[model samples]
Target: MSQSKITPKSYKVLAVDDNEDITELLEYTLSKEGYQVKTTWDGSTAIQLAQSFLPDLILLDISMPIMDGIEAGRLLRQIPALDYTFLIYLTARVEEYAEVAAFDIGADDYLIKPIKPRALVSRLKALLRDKNELAYSSTEFRIGDLKIDSLSYTINYQNKVLQLPKKEFELLYFLVQHQDTVYTREQLLSHVWGAGMHITPRTIDVHIRKIRERTGFDYIKTVKGIGYKFTTEPENT
Candidate 1:
């Protein structure tokens, strides 16, 4: 079965690569697909452009002169205006550690080089679709002293506002909404990250840890030999 092609032209993309040819290819291919594309050959310029362009997605190369995608991604995450912007590392690095590091630094997706244009477009469509669906699903949630506002993508804990990365916030929201229901890693992966995605289950743990650290809340209960649950009655409360 073939799925219908979604509108790609409505989105803006920022492509950053040290190789001019790669950037050119990205610009040409994405432009042909109707996307508003901008290209940069250096990470520093990519960062600067991102502030004004405010792209919906960023295609970054891990190895670049003057600055690298990892550093650039870290800095981008700190920008409140770009908090919801999708970030993808499009590089040639194949090491597992590199992939893990990219996600740790807040990349929404990671792709290797030599990819087919059709496949790249498909990936982008899927990512954007998932993002939009998540955005429209729910608007706000309140659990105990924690409050989540999906529109702003911000959380309030004990009246203190704390901003979370996109994935972390989604994970926390999902668990809190279904409080006390035990969810296995696989279930969490499906519900929070979208079904059939290549993301690892351990990624859930990383987000969970970050949520705990940021909120200083003990509401998420780890079920041994199973998974985790968000409890209404937090331990030691």
Candidate 2:
């Protein structure tokens, strides 16, 4: 998993390229960093891999046989279930159209083909760093009695531990890290799911319920027309 490589935690990465050499290079490069990576030449299998891997990031090639990267990306984005997968594209040097298309379809970044293995690794590390930073910039937050580690993804309450599923953990981490900030379903979907994933806005509600049930954060407030907020400090009545 991508997370495992960088943070000693489970994180997965999916790399797609019709060229065996390119796929192999990416897998080798990323794996050297202790990242768990999966790669394939088949674009049709992209969605299936996504569902199974729940990758932290996907590096997709723009051109391929059978199914193209654009189509694969569109399909992934249309699922309305995977809300947290980041996407980057590998394009030929002359493929300007593919670059534009990659961004239009929701790719966060793009790299020219015949990639420098070292450079690719560097970019991935930088991307992950920014992601972690943006997701957990807060100093501290308490949702009810639950205490969350902004950097570690560890949670505790009243000296008791609370375990969470992969997606659930990420969602709760985001909410508590940004306590007191009201976030709409779409915003949460975008940030948590990533631009590469297609997810319904209402999925937040389900995760919210799951979060409330699993932890002591019974005080998570709903804004009705908007979304939810977890306030560490109680409101003055």
Candidate 3:
């Protein structure tokens, strides 16, 4: 069975930018598109608001006083409640490293600023659509002693709870669901990141490494010349 499409009104967005004008534009644009919107001027305030608002997506500006988006994103990623929240960077920084830093902190997407409201809304809709598709069934399942609860996005191993960032969780969940089916990096990107998303194949490797670090190498195994897969058999590590 396919998941139902999420309506715009059912979506909530938080826009954070030091520029009042840009925030106002974001509010106006997204609101008109039927999303519930909140605006904040600084990263700290955005974090506070996110805890209460629990927004489905965040439009964050990379440059802001008191706290920058990168720091805010890192902290936000640590919040288990916001683990699945989509974070997109709205910044003027066009440097390659800046984009790398954003992705390193778990950014879902990045938009270089000129504040094109319509295009931004399009991106948000696409992202939310992809998220809805990735949403797992509410049921929880176990592979040996490892427990993955789709409802709360929690992983329990050996009676201890483990939390991974959003992307990592999705990647691991996908592999576990399709145990023993080896997937190439490009295939994993399309399946997990969704089609047309600007994620590269290398991003898959990075996420795979992190997943191993957090959950150990028992489940997901790399196929030397191919890609990776989840297996019930013990890895020969």
Q: Which parts of model 3 are misplaced by more than 4 Å?
A: 1-6, 92-97, 111-119, 130-136
Best by TM-score: 1
The clash numbers for all candidates, in the given order, read 0, 11, 0
Local accuracy of candidate 3 as per-residue lDDT tens digits, 164-197:
7777787888899899999999899888766665
Residue pairs in steric clash, candidate 1? none
lDDT (Cα, 0-100) at 204 in candidate 1: 72
User: Which lDDT value does model 3 have at 145?
Assistant: 87
> Residue 9, candidate 1: how far off, in angstroms?
3.1
Query: Once model 2 is optimally superposed onto the true structure by TM-score, how far is the C-alpha of residue 98 displaced, in angstroms?
Result: 2.0
Please list the C-alpha lDDT of all candidates, in the order they appear: 0.83, 0.70, 0.83
Per residue, candidate 2 scores C-alpha lDDT tens digits across 1-237 of 333224813567899988888888888888888789999886798888888778888888877888999889877766545555667777784455555455555555666767888777777776687666645564455555677765544578888876554345667777776777998988886776565433445457766776677775565678889997766664421
Off by over 4 Å in 1: 1-7
Ranking 1 against 2 by TM-score, winner: 1
Per-residue lDDT value at 61 in model 2: 82
